[model samples]
Target: MGSIVLTHLKSAWHVDQAILDDEEKIVVLRFGKTTDAAVMAMDEHLSKIADRVQNFASIYVVDNKEVPDFNAMYELYDACTVMFFFRNKHILVDCGTGNNNKINFSIADKQDLIDIIEVVYRGARKGKGLVVSPKDYATQMKY
Candidate 1:
């Protein structure tokens, strides 16, 4: 005889606090305005815990003004400014554009579009929870 059992699987969404708390290194990609003050502030904060943080943490500022092709700015970092963070496993990406509302959507400027990159990066790194089929049939059948 063949029988089928169905179980409910709950998925939880959470920020990987460990990723930030235990991070030994942090890399920031500053484009557009490229604020030195912010960089200095972050550096100062990180320096306090430098002893506990054992990895290499550095900030790279890439001014979009220097780039010959503005459109290529997105491509500069894998179609997103935050890609560097993913590539280097950094905790955050501060693109110099203050907040989402501050961004000028009317313009396709690199600075304005940086937020899009940030959003995509945030979404990929911390996915929203959704109920889906389990990888193992036995686990699914048990619920």
Candidate 2:
């Protein structure tokens, strides 16, 4: 139900506007299907912290199937991809997964997601296009 409440970007124009129009808060776009297991998990986590990080970030969900305009540009091939942007600049996150692009996995922990969002917001505000994630996702052992 969390995924149902979050704002969904339905077109290429909307996506572009979301990226371009936000001059202050960090824009977070989740690209994937809400029906997918991993995406559902990620969306749930994102929804939980939407309010906590509302001051610094704006979360929006984009269905890859609906908005295929960014498939090759941003590489929306993952089951779930979370990308960040600020002031029309794409903000990359080094998640230690060797992919300094977008987060292509589910982060189950709410606090962990919040921490990462905070880090991204802080870095973006400082005029940095990329920020290192608080958690080295590749190094952590997942149960």
Q: Please, what is the TM-score per model?
A: 0.25, 0.95
Give the alpha carbon lDDT tens digit for every residue of 1-143 in model 2. 78876899999999999999989999999999778888888888999999999999999999998889999999888888999999998899999988888888768889999999999999999999889999889964322
Per-model CA lDDT versus the true structure: 0.30, 0.89
Work out candidate 2's RMSD over C-alphas.
1.8
Off by over 4 Å in 1: 1-24, 33-56, 68-84, 88-143
In angstroms, give how far residue 67 of model 2 lies from its true place.
0.9
Model 1: which residue pairs collide? 7-143
C-alpha lDDT of residue 30 in model 2: 95
lDDT of 1 by residue, 1-143 (tens): 00011111111111123223323333333333223443233233333433332234333334344542432524433212322343334332223333211111122233323333434344435642111111212211100
Best by TM-score: 2
* Error of model 1, residue 86, in angstroms: 3.7
